[model samples]
Target chain A: MAATNLSERRLARFWSKYGFVLAVLVPILLWFSIFSFGPILYALYASLTNTHSLDPSRARFVGLDNYISLLDDRRFLASMSNVFRFVLVKGILNIVLSLGLALLLERLRRGRNFYLFFIFMPVVISQVAVAMLFLWLYDPRLGLINYLLSLVEIPPQSFIRSTAQAIYSVAIADVWKTYGYAAVIFLAGLLDIPQDYYEAAKVDGATRLQTLWRVTLPLLKNPLVLVMVLIVIDGVQHFTMVQVMTGGGPADSTLMPSILVYNYGLGANNYRMGYACAISFIMFVVIMAITVFQLRLFRSLYD
Target chain B: MTDISLDRRAGGSLPSGGAGADARIRLREQVIALVTHLLLVIFAFIAFGAMMWMVLASFKSASEIIAKPPTFLPEAPTLESYALILREQAFGRFFLNSIFVALPSVLLILFSSSIAGFVFAKFDFPAKEVIFTIILSTLMVPPAVTLLPLFRLVSRLGWADTYQALIIPVCVSAFGIFLLRQFMEGLPSELLDAGRIDGASNWWIYRHIVLPLSVSALSALAIFSFLANWDSYLWPLVIIYEEKMRTLPLGLAYLLGWSSRPRYDLFLTGAVITVVPVVVFYSFFQSRFVRGVTLTGLKY
Candidate 1:
């Protein structure tokens, strides 16, 4: 009876602790379960169905047809190609430009904050606004790029209006808007390296370029991977700029996967809900795969 | 701050009181530094030049803006673009919509994530590790993948175009909880011990002790949450259907319009409207913002 009584008291104490844990965890869990996890699960299910309308309950299961159909979809194919191009070009520019700018900023004695403010300003602005801003900058006749080109004695080029140049133009605008963020992140990483390392390198009579290659780059491995991963994930989700500035224009040149999904699932004349989900999942798998590959590639290189 | 000094010393820019060889090396280093300085200055101007161009264009007449060589400066600067957008277009409505969606979403994430962080940091409960890991693992689930079902889920809840649709789905961030927990881990547990020993309720301890101590993290997360929600595009674009309900980004996108005609000046003005305030706000808390990005790197 005494042992039974002790066990009962233990149970009560367990309940009290569980109560506190539940109070905090339940809301977030409920939120995640309902909004995040549930929806993703729902998306998986919907991908197998022909759910065109908003009411997903009415969706009829069509097996793997939606997935199969996406394989042959021309626009979807175009979007994937666009995504690969974007990831490649944007990825290279981010690392090179940001690292270069960060090194330069690190070397500067004054006006670091001012430089940061201007560079990082685009990041704070909504993508919609940036897209709109660039639309003007990419204007065929009067845009900033062409105007600058003319001043250099080069003929004005129809940037976004031309089919061949449209996607690259869009990508360039995006690179400009986002590279500042990479620079800032790299700068932070640079700042955290112990100053003593530099002094030691100085004592050894190392050149700035040599020391940077041997010391700074090596020290920056983690931050570099982090920056690369972050940029990849963010870049792969490219939609707004394509949508607003070009709208996958000049013959579907800039139609990214996200834009493709939005177009199919939500565009006025197109509402292939089932197919959209399938495409989204395809893109999801692609993003995850690239992320894993990037991390492993960096690990092999540095570690 | 150390970056500057370390770089100077590393380059041997300041002579170490030496002979002919050292002086030549210093001169070479000085020349390199000068070149680097010139390059950075040019880059800075070009970087900030985008904003300068936008602001200048916003002040120019439509004809003046698209002139052959283009007006570098507005010869007769006017506020007509601003007036046109605000009065004729629905710029003001879209601006308010963004605030409405962003503010609530930011606040909700802060309150829930902070409290959750506190609990995760302090409490020893059943399944704590497993549960925390589950939450952390889901952080990588891209929003793009969930777009379809989320839209349907919002539709089912009868909140398709409402601000609630925007607020509810994004209100809880796994990343935010994880970040705050990392912060709370550094707090001396004894800091809350006094409150606990005094027979105060857990809520009271969390509110009076944990919340106050976690202000720095909270503020950092606040900026992140706010900026993130403000800059968000696809979700708002998909969820919202009504014209007046459009957020700033959506409005700016539509200003490009489905039509062939381009209105550069007004579009630039609208862009400025959406961008200026957030940039100004960020300027005030620049250090916090930098620290926030750095903390994100450590998440790896």
Candidate 2:
């Protein structure tokens, strides 16, 4: 009786020590399991089978068929190439503009926040809203851009209407919306660098350009890597702005893989969930590969 | 502050330089400053001007919105577009639905993340590192990978067109948990220990001590998560079939298909309605939003 009572008392102590932790963590982990982990595992399984979006129970195993077909699939190829161009255009413009803005902001003696407030305003709004604004701005007939171009005697351009300019036009609008975010990140990274470094560079009589190249850029490697990877990942998975602006239109010129996934998985009479999942997995692998490549590249460049 | 010293250092002349050279250098610095401010003002104007144009366009008449040589200011500014959208599009319902989904989701994320962060920060438990790593790894998986499966799951649960469909899947953010954990770990443990010594329960100590001290991090997370939920589109588009069940973004997008041709007037008005509230909120907590960006590097 004495031993049993002692063991019960120890159990009570253990419960008292860990009850709250278990109560909090159990639900959260369960949530992750149900929502996060479960869906990922399900996608992996569904990608290998012929599944319908509405009727998963009828799915039949089809080994590598979807993956093999995607290799030659014209639309899939277009999406892959389109996303490649999208990431490239977005990464270059976003970096240059944001870095320039960051440098400019870093030099300001006053009204820094005021400038940032206006610049960062776009980052906070909805992608669809931005798309709507740009749609009007890019309107062939009534757009302000065309009107301004007419003032300069430049002919009106079909921004999203033409196949060639559609992707770049969408890219430009996205850049306008997102560059400020990278600017803020770069600005934060800039401010974190010690002023003593600049003073040291000055003592050596390094020109402004030399100081920026040898000192500032090297010190900013982390944020640069961060911003680049984010741009790549975001650009690769981009859907909302493109979907809202064009719905991958003007002869599939801007058909992103995410849009393809939606078209295949859920379009009326096109419930090819398995095919869509295959595309999603490809996108996943591409994002992972590019991200790792970027990290490795940046590491080698600076290290 | 640092700029002041930098300016002084730049303005200070070489010991061998004459007064003319000093004047020249001062002129050069002033020219650089002028050019810098000029370029910055243009950049700022471009950024702010587009949104301002969108706002002004919303009030113009339908024909004037798309009129030739587009009017910079609405010649006859009116509330007709707003009245049309509110009455015909049921935007008010969409607004309420957005609030209904976002408020609960943000609150739940905060509660779950902070409490879990508190546990991870203050407690020693088995498999803690393993669990945290697992959660963090999920951040790398893009939402597209899970889109189909989640749709399947939610539909299976008979939750399509339900508010829970919007709220539940996103309620506990991995990023939020990670952010709050990083924050709560910085909080002084002595305060928590003092509460413990006073025989307070872990819950009480978290409620009174950890929660209060974590206001900054919590608020940042709240703003970000709230914005994310408010701006979410694809999920709501897929799940919500009912007009009344739409979120703001969804309702705004539907305005495009509502008319045969592009209605710039209604589109701008809907956009104005969609964007103004967040911009207003952002105006108030502008620093927190910026800090949240640096803190989490989240792009909305």
In terms of DockQ, which candidate is strongest?
Answer: 1
For residue B84, model 2's alpha carbon misses the true position, in angstroms, by 1.2
Model 2, A1-303: lDDT tens per residue?
999999999989989988898999989989998999999988888899999998877899999999999999999999999999999999999999999998988778778888899999998998889999999999999899999999999999999999999999999999999999999888887777777788888899999999999999999999899999899989989999999999998999999999999999999999999999999999999999999999999999999
Off by over 4 Å in 2: A1-3, B1-21, B298-300
Per-residue lDDT of candidate 2, residues B6-97 (tens digit): 12233333233355566777778778888888888988998999999999998888888988877888999899999988999999998899
Residue A161 in candidate 1, Cα distance off native in Å: 2.1
Clashes of each: 0, 0
lDDT per residue as tens, model 1, A1-303:
999999999999877767777878888899999988888888888889998845456778899999899889899899888888877888888789889999888877777877777777776667777788788887777687877787789998888888788878888888888887788778877876777788888899999888999899989988788888887787777777878878887788888888888888988877878888898888788878988998999889888
Q: Give the distance in Å from residue A1's predicted Cα in candidate 1 to where it truly belongs.
A: 12
Residue A169, model 1: lDDT of 83
Model 1 pairs in collision: none
lDDT of 1 at A174: 84
User: How many angstroms is residue B53 displaced in model 1 relative to the true structure, after the best TM-score fit?
Assistant: 1.2
The deviation in Å at residue A145 for candidate 1 is 1.3
Error (Å) of candidate 2 at residue B73 is: 1.2
